[model samples]
Target chain A: MDYAARNFAAEGYHTTSVTSIVNGLGVGKGVFYWYFASKDELLGEILGDALRSMREAQRDAIAGEPDPARRIDQGIRASLHWLSENRHLFVLMEFARTEERFAPIIRRGDDQMVADALPHVSAGITAGLLRGEDPVFLTMAILGVSGHLARTLVLEQGNDADRVAESVIAFCRQGYLATGTPALARRSA
Target chain B: MDYAARNFAAEGYHTTSVTSIVNGLGVGKGVFYWYFASKDELLGEILGDALRSMREAQRDAIAGEPDPARRIDQGIRASLHWLSENRHLFVLMEFARTEERFAPIIRRGDDQMVADALPHVSAGITAGLLRGEDPVFLTMAILGVSGHLARTLVLEQGNDADRVAESVIAFCRQGYLATGTPALARRSA
Candidate 1:
């Protein structure tokens, strides 16, 4: 899977051949087919595995934490740590997002991410520790902050996970703590 | 440019031929080559034009705003409005980000976006109205928040600009107002 991921990340997924993946690993074609049905299937598995690993890391980090807000902090840090450690997966996911064939798979992963974070956000809102904004909006905003920071600080600039995670946690926590109406002030409505 | 933009947005850039671009508009191939030397050059122009338009909108909205925080608020709304009106361009830009050939083009636009928002953030920091976080970090966070909301509310969910902007502005303002040290509390650092 790592070999396939490396190839897909380095070479465009559409351009990378199944033969290249097997050849790169010095493995027989039969061996490759024995595990995966096709190149597309392999890509799907890679996406699934990456999402599972990420979720596991996030869940493990937040386990036994009773405070919803603090769990959010842990979740952000865990995500950044995972992104930092699996930089290649980030690149692979980026490639996957552009293609129509993989967008649904990517979208599912994204939705699952939001779902995983939803409970904590809901808890915060219920406890009145965070703003009473639409939970989905808050969740996506938190994710956007973390994902972009991970890409900019950890992935591109080679910064450590702790540093990137700190910035993400601080910014997100502040956003959550603010009091505001989620509805827009539309004129001529 | 709109013709080419629409075609590229609808059909993936890598799959869309220059011939198709010209033929779709019922123009001679020379007319296409007259203004641009290659399809890649045309893609760069499309990106630059979009960025210029977005910056103009942001700048115009923030003009004459005395308060740094208000300027930031105006900036976010302006960005959301521009993005709401330019959804197709987002898809094109997403495609551009994945390809190595277009990463530089996208990176330049991203860096320029950060530079444009930096002064307001720096001013807020100096005035002690906002957290004294790294200016780049703050700017990117602000952009990330706006961009994500724009995508989620405006693009995917088909929500109005005013509605999405309200949530983004509220969240960003709170983050900016929070007092926290930007540095991570690294153990054994």
Candidate 2:
């Protein structure tokens, strides 16, 4: 699975053939067929495993954290760190999003991510720690910020994932306004 | 261009052949080749034009707005409105990002977008109206929130573009913290 995923991420999914994968590994077609039905199924499994692993990282990061806002922060940090380590999988995920046959897997993973984070968002709002915006939108906003920044900064720009995570948390928690500024003060009023 | 873009968005880009596009439009092969040299060139042009048009909309929306922060808000609203209207092109844009040959076009367009917004973000930070974090990261955070939200909410979930824009701006401005909350107050302190 790792070999196939690296191939898919380096070469386009459609361009990477099963023949090449088996050939590269010096394995017979029988060995490949014994494990997976087809290339499509293999790619699906790759995506599912990647998403599940990412969620696990996030869950582990936030475990035993009592503060809702801090939980969200730990989740963002965990996500960025995982994404940085699994940059190849991240690229594959984006590529999968573009294909129709693969979009369902991506969508399901995204929905699962939102479901996982929704409770903390709700908790924050309930405790008056977060704004009274729709919890789903707020959750989506956090996902958007973390995913996009990880792609642009960590993966593409070679920036440190931990630092980018810090920037993301700061932006998510306090937004653009500086501390005690008139604009922020007025908005708070 | 419009016909081809619609087809590319509906059918997968690779599946939509030049012949099918010409046949659907009731145009001869000569007429198609007269404008574009190849199918790849046609899709490239489509993606380029869509990005250019979107930027123009943002520019027009923010024209004569003196306040940098308000200008950023207008820019986000303009982007959502444009993406909602030209959703087909947006899908095509996402697809274009996946292919190796087409990734440069998307990257260039994204860079142009960041460049356009960087000045305003810098101005806001300089004026103490925005956070003193790296201006580039702040600009990317805004883009990330607006783009991701628009894709999930407006494009997929069928939410109103304007309403989504409001949510985006509110989040970008004040983040996830509620007004006068102890979390926010403590952060400021």
Candidate 2 lDDT by residue in tens digits, A49-142: 9999999999999999898998999899999999999998998988777667888899899999999999999999999889887999999999
> For every model shown, what is its TM-score relative to the native structure?
0.87, 0.93
For model 1, residues B107-130, the per-residue Cα lDDT tens digits are 788888889989988897776667
List ranges where model 2 is wrong by over 4 Å: A182-189, B29-31, B182-189
Docking tier of model 2: it is medium
DockQ of each: 0.33, 0.63
Pairs clashing within candidate 2: none
Q: After superposition, how far is residue A34 of candidate 2 from its true place, in Å?
A: 3.6
Write model 1 residue lDDT over A73-160, tens digit each, in one string: 8888899999999877887776666666776787788889899999999897787777777887788889988887787778767889
CA lDDT of A82 in candidate 2? 99
